[model samples]
Target chain A: SQTIHQWPATLVQPVGSPLSLECTVEGTSNPNLYWYRQAAGRGLQLLFYSVGIGQISSEVPQNLSASRPQDRQFILSSKKLLLSDSGFYLCAWNPSGRKTQYFGPGTRLLVL
Target chain B: AQSVSQHNHHVILSEAASLELGCNYSYGGTVNLFWYVQYPGQHLQLLLKYFSGDPLVKGIKGFEAEFIKSKFSFNLRKPSVQWSDTAEYFCAVSYGSTLGRLYFGRGTQLTVWP
Candidate 1:
């Protein structure tokens, strides 16, 4: 069985601070990874998706960026955080050419 | 560009009542549909999906959804919803051969009173 891990589960950061959220998937290789932000009342907004290592697609340009360093490791980062950047950030992964995606526990970031 | 629309933003129902959440998509091609449930303080889980074949797809926890191709809709239904069934339901659609990129709806929050 495959498992996805994300940390830290909750984060509190001041404005203009750097942000880094990690997501790793075990038991799967060459999986498609995605980063999404869920705001209050609003649905999920896809931020980035990676098909392979060093290949990232930005669904919506914003303050955040995503990277796939290793086959199973994905990272979401930001040089400076904004108040609007605060939300429930979720990471999801699925096998290549598959429609179903498995989501991680998610990171709740609060930018004060 | 593909887009999904879920009619109800929020719904309040008593236990044992029938539940129906409307979902529609705007895409003129072969597509895949999925329904995901997010329990309180938990991650998103797949309730059911429609790839092909059966128009009516049954999911876990006694939940089901019907896919109407002509209507471009996939509506989730539950004959008797339990209090544990209270959660947020999301409808997503993937078009053509893009299997990993899904367009999600605004989502419908279901609240069931015990």
Candidate 2:
């Protein structure tokens, strides 16, 4: 079975601080990875997606970025955090040949 | 560009009441539809999906959704909802030609009272 894992279930960061959130998938290779953010009971907003290592497509301009260094490892980072950056961040993956997306336990970020 | 829409923002129903949530998508080509549930304090889980063949798809916990191509709607239905069914439901769509990136709707929050 495929599973996705994300670290730091909850985070509190100060303004202008650096941030990094990691996501890793098990039982799958060359999967499509995505980053999404949900603001307090709102719909998900796509942040970034990667098809392969070093290849990324960002959906919106923001204070964050994403990277895929390994086949199943994805990272979301920000050089300087903003108060508006606090939200529920989700990481998801879809197997190479399927449309069903598997989601990981999200990271709740609180920027002060 | 493809987009998804869920009609209900919030619904309150008593236990054993019938439940239906509306979802619609706008896409020119073939698309795959999905419904996901997120219980309070939990991650999102797939409830059901529609790839092809049957217009009606059954999901876990006695939930089902019907896909109407002409209407561009995939409405979720349950004969009798339980109090435990209180959760937020999301509708998503992936264009057949896209790279499996799903476009999600605003979502509908369902609250079932005891």
Put down candidate 2 lDDT per residue, A1-112, tens digits, no spaces.
Answer: 8889999999999999999999999998899999999997678888999989999999999899999989999999999999999999999998777899889999999999
In order, what DockQ does each candidate have? Answer: 0.76, 0.72
In candidate 2, position B55 carries an lDDT of: 98
TM-score of chain B of each: 0.97, 0.97
* Residue A46 lDDT (model 1): 86
Q: Candidate 1, residues A1-112: lDDT per residue as tens digits?
A: 9999999999999999999999999998999999999998888888999999999999898898898989999999999999999999999999998889899999999999
True contacts kept of 1: 0.70
What fraction of the native interface does candidate 2 get right in terms of contacts? Answer: 0.59
Q: Highest DockQ among the candidates is held by which one?
A: 1
| lDDT score, candidate 1 | 0.93
